[model samples]
Target: MTAPHTGGCRCGAVRFEASAEPHHISYCHCGDCRRASGAPVSAFVGFMADQIALDGKSLKTFENGPVTRSFCGVCGSPIAYVDERLADQIYFMLGAMDMPAYFRPTLHAHVREQLPFLHMPDDLPRHLKTSVPRPSSSNPDGTQS
Candidate 1:
């Protein structure tokens, strides 16, 4: 299903679109995610990075040891959470996208930092940390079929 949604950086200079459907959707409460988004839990929809059209400029990435966080240089919006091992897939902040409320945590990562008031439901897999899978394609760029 094609959900024609669009969003941009805080400065509104950078924008993106998921012409097709999304890949992974989740709510992450990790420390890195909190710091990156300045929220208790950050929502994201995974996508083939190259699949999402970036109309303005590219992102400015910050390497925090094992992972890197990227954002629009013009808007400085929290754009994605990227693991070096899974460079093939990128998680675009769900809250950043202009779509209906689609908050479903497929898996909870970083239980240590999860809000104490919030208890995870057994329906979804819970993990201390998660490593999202790369798309099936083997292209150097993050474009999917």
Candidate 2:
């Protein structure tokens, strides 16, 4: 079997491994993501929840409505984001990945909420809202295929 993708919090208080290749990758410019990551934009790698194993005592979670975000309780490094609608999948913060450079975002989400000063000069497809379709389970990539 291939080696699992690995990552951890800044202080080494939280660590995780994903056994499967990511099914989706994208950049989110929504205000919620920005506030959660404390960055102008947040990139994520999405994997089936069952494929991820988080091993750490400092993992904590915050819930707002249907969204629950996980972070390192010790270093406060953002970890993963999950939405009730997409409960089967977990979106891990790209910045927390051990090899963030290996994952390239395929699209940009919530473009309408993107900060005016943040200019990404890429030809990636941009969506005004979440790229993932709601009430969806099998197609996290937001593609009809």
Structural similarity to truth (TM-score) of each candidate: 0.73, 0.90
lDDT score for residue 92 of model 2? 94
Model 1, residue 1: distance off in Å is 5.6
Locate the minimum summed-lDDT window of 10 residues in model 2: 136-145
Prediction 1 TM-score vs. true:
0.73
Tens-digit lDDT track for model 2 on 49-142? 9999989888999999879999999989999989998869999999999999999999999899999999999999998888887674345765
The candidate scoring highest on TM-score is 2
**What's the lDDT for all of these models?**
0.70, 0.91
lDDT of 1 by residue, 74-96 (tens): 76788776666676666778767
lDDT of 1: 0.70
RMSD of each: 6.6, 3.8
